[model samples]
Target: MCLISFYLIFVFSMTLFIFGIYFILYDYSLFIEWEVVSMNSLSIVMTLLFDWMSFIFMSFVLMISSLVIYYSKEYMFHDYKINRFIMLVLMFVGSMMLLIISPNLISILLGWDGLGLISYCLVIYFQNVKSYNAGMLTVLSNRIGDVALLLSIAWMLNYGSWNYIFYLEFMKNYSEMMIVGVLILMASLTKSAQIPFSSWLPAAMAAPTPVSALVHSSTLVTAGVYLMIRFNLLLYNSWLSSLLLILSSLTMFMSGLGANYEFDLKKIIALSTLSQLGLMMSILSIGYSKLAFFHLLTHALFKALLFMCAGAIIHNMNNNQDIRLMGSLSLLMPLTSTCFNVANLALCGMPFLAGFYSKDLILESVLFSYVNFFTFLLFFLSTGLTVCYSFRLVFYSMTGEFNFSPLNLLNNESWIMLSSMLSLLYLSIIFGSILNWLIFSSPILILLPIYLKLFTLFVCFLGGLMGYMISNVSIYFYNKSLHYYNLSSFFGLMWFMPYISTYGVINNYLMMGQLSFKLFDQGWSEYFGGQNLYFLMKYNSQLNQVLQNNNLKIYLLSFVFIVVILFMFL
Candidate 1:
């Protein structure tokens, strides 16, 4: 079943890829619209947009999803619910495809909600407490974006059409459209896991690794960036763009710093995904939607590869994920390690690799754009931090002495998994160059000083060195972080983002819920509503029973008292 799914999806991916290329070459776009209803000058239509961007993105999504499905056959072979997992993954891919093709806000909402729902199911696939918590965080965080999209839909209703593509050009002329743009920005920020919504991206690592690779790399997280790209005109030159730039830069910086202190292999990669997402968002915020899209495509290729390699390692290590306990894996699992290293270097934007093309272009563009020093510093520092964590990951998990028990045997003999990874491996190597050439009709002119041009390369080298040194220091010393306990905890704990997202954001609301339960549901409502009415009725019934039991004697006394009262009145 998995193989059949893989073959079908792979074929579809290739077909879409070819179609995407043709569309781009010819600058052609196909829009299919079906009018569902027309009433009182209001027409409801379902729309699908097939253009170079949507086709290419859809193709990449399907390709990665196919490889992941193939990889999961081995990764989840021992599990009883493997079929369920495969179905959920396929559903996720479907949601992403729907999102990619839809230009209308309503149709986009359908796909957006589908991604959230399916992602929740996949995250909790393991049915453990951790998985459950992670799933909750992931869903609730994404729900914010869902609400934003819904609001945008409602706001766009005033414009007489749910099709946003028609309005993007004219929206900038009217100030009311700025609200729609802001709503879209909020939705994108949450979906992409930007600042204040980032904790879920890493916590979602509780999901199966294949899900991680697909969700983090392309489907769920990238949905935001994709949305922003579609609405680039709405956001371009708006205050929302500047806001997005600041938040995304902080997101990038925070995640990069957090990844360095993280030991969980999947979480580290997840943070890296967060960092890269911030990069995409930042670039998009600065009017380089195409550049952001370029980075997004290239990022998907290598990040998916990175996650698969991590999955393979975790599978061999008997489900252990702590990088601290892994070392010298290259000796035993040569092929997997090689693929892992390639993916890592590609992530660092190593020369001639997939990441280098997009990342290099993005940095140059940032330098070319007139921006504040703060944004510039965050960009370069985050770039270095990315290299730092990548190298740290390689050094700790792939090199040095073996840290596992001597009796444990590890090997990269899982042909099914390795083959799936190998499929993506070459793409991670060359996809950037291919995408760069295809996306741009002509070369982008980036004019920068010699020093500025070399800056990115210098940061990569320095970050790699720092990563190596940090790993060595930690290995040699016992509890080195204990000295800077508070500082370490802050960086390691994602700047308390999980706490803020879960405990911080929910604490007041939870307290209010509890209070409401006590004051209304349990206390006031119970007393004044059901219990109080019941007691009052009981008392009246008791008095009636006593009056009824008084009989003839009480009747005689009542008559005498009435006569006396009449005489006094007279």
Candidate 2:
């Protein structure tokens, strides 16, 4: 069978890269054996190259693919549509493999788009109205990202050397690096769900539990972070690096807030991931490439575990989704309880877990970076927000009082689900302590930060405690002040009109008493109404009407316009 062949090839790849993920997670390196792919493969025109970064990323993909299989095998075991799920997942795995292994940026893009297309199909496969909406939204948002990527390629092709190495060299010489920088940054921003481009990911929570668990949380969303790291040189040199930093911080805070307000089991994790990627971006912004990559690698492991555990939770609740109706899962399902607690603790970034190491590393790198105080503050605040929402989801779902129970799973729990979650929990616990040997070439530099690492652990737990307390209180009240002011009120609405009118004076527009424009009477048939009033009447309406129709038509036809007018604004 084709499935068997792909699985065997995948196993072989994992066996070859044994040291990649195992070292980070369990220090289980028994599987990986390394060999260099021939450097002289059929070459594209650009200078082809291989580097340590590419090697590490490929290895991470291999590990994730292996685990995804482990998950798919048990998760989709008996469903009538099992074959379809298996094929889709395998396709996802192959895309990830090609992405990480590719030496050329063009080649990298093949896997990037491949992963996105496959995810869209998987999300929509259930054919439910919710699933269909999620898939369409996913497609819409990712296309905004594709436009950015195509522009990035255009910039490179127009100005830089066509080869990867020469491209980097070419970038070093360009005065308009800002143009190239913005395009690349935009692509990654949309892909990573960082602000203004972020609405699609939350909507994507409509997919099945397993797909949500594996693809959305751990694998697919991580592609953007991988891209950022893969092209760090662009970030390191460009003026937009600081912009990336600030955007990342804002995204972290915003998504964290969303996750707190979410009720759906899958959505809680989905929002959590968007915030996690924000943290990763901020990490990259601070010049900590390896640190950010480690967090990505670390997050994929624990998040996958958490998503699977959430899947099991949904199954046990008799399809009851609201945390309000289900409670006391800790006692009801001990194994699920244990796995949930472990993964949640890891997600909470508890000490000594896989989450703790990468997180502390990111914070330490941020604290120590030469960036200014305000940047540090935003970074710190985002960190606090991530912890706040992560455990809010955990406590609400698995820890409270039971109000209802599902009939079929009143006491049912599957071994496959338990083992899959347990594997992730184990990896998150020990990943940081052992697997970072290659990343930390200097023992002494890593040693000075022991106290700071412990502090982050404490802060992580404290954030979780605060989240638990805030959960019972209404969110509106938690954020509400002693008194709230309405922005649309008379004073607030009129407050800015005078300033704008004053500025309009510089443009030679008379606001003295009348809204009229007198152009310096160039020899127009001015006395007879400018150049040709009768002729103008044939082609034009009032400015507002002309604009309203012209702009309105263009705007109305846009996806963003339709969504904004009908959905967001309404």
For all predictions, the C-alpha RMSD in Å is 4.2, 15.3
The prediction achieving the highest TM-score against the true structure is: 1
Off by over 4 Å in 2: 1-10, 19-52, 159-161, 406-408, 444-455, 472-570
In Å, residue 328's CA in model 2 sits off its true spot by 0.6
TM-score of each: 0.92, 0.75
**What is the Cα-based lDDT of residue 276 in candidate 1?**
97
- Each model's C-alpha lDDT? 0.91, 0.67
Per-residue lDDT over 1-570 for candidate 2, one digit per residue giving the tens place of the 0 to 100 score: 334733675567555455444444443322121333446653334223334455455655555555555666665666687777767877887787666655456656677788789889988977888788678767766776777777776666675343343465556567675566676678788778787667677677777676776675546777778777767777776666788888888777767665665567777777778778998998897777888887887787777777777777777676667766666777778787787778766766777888877777777766566878877766666566667776666666566667774444555356655666776677777766754665665552544476664666666667777787777563324643213445323222223222332234323343533333343244344646755676587567665466576565666567576677788566
Model 1 regions more than 4 Å off: 37-43, 478-480, 529-570
The most accurate candidate by lDDT is: 1
Q: Mind giving the per-residue lDDT tens digits that candidate 1 earns over 277-321?
A: 999999988899999999999999889999999998898888899
**Candidate 1 local Cα displacement, residue 564, angstroms:** 19
Question: Model 1: how far is 496 from its true place, Å?
Answer: 1.3
lDDT for residue 241 in candidate 2, whole number 0-100: 79
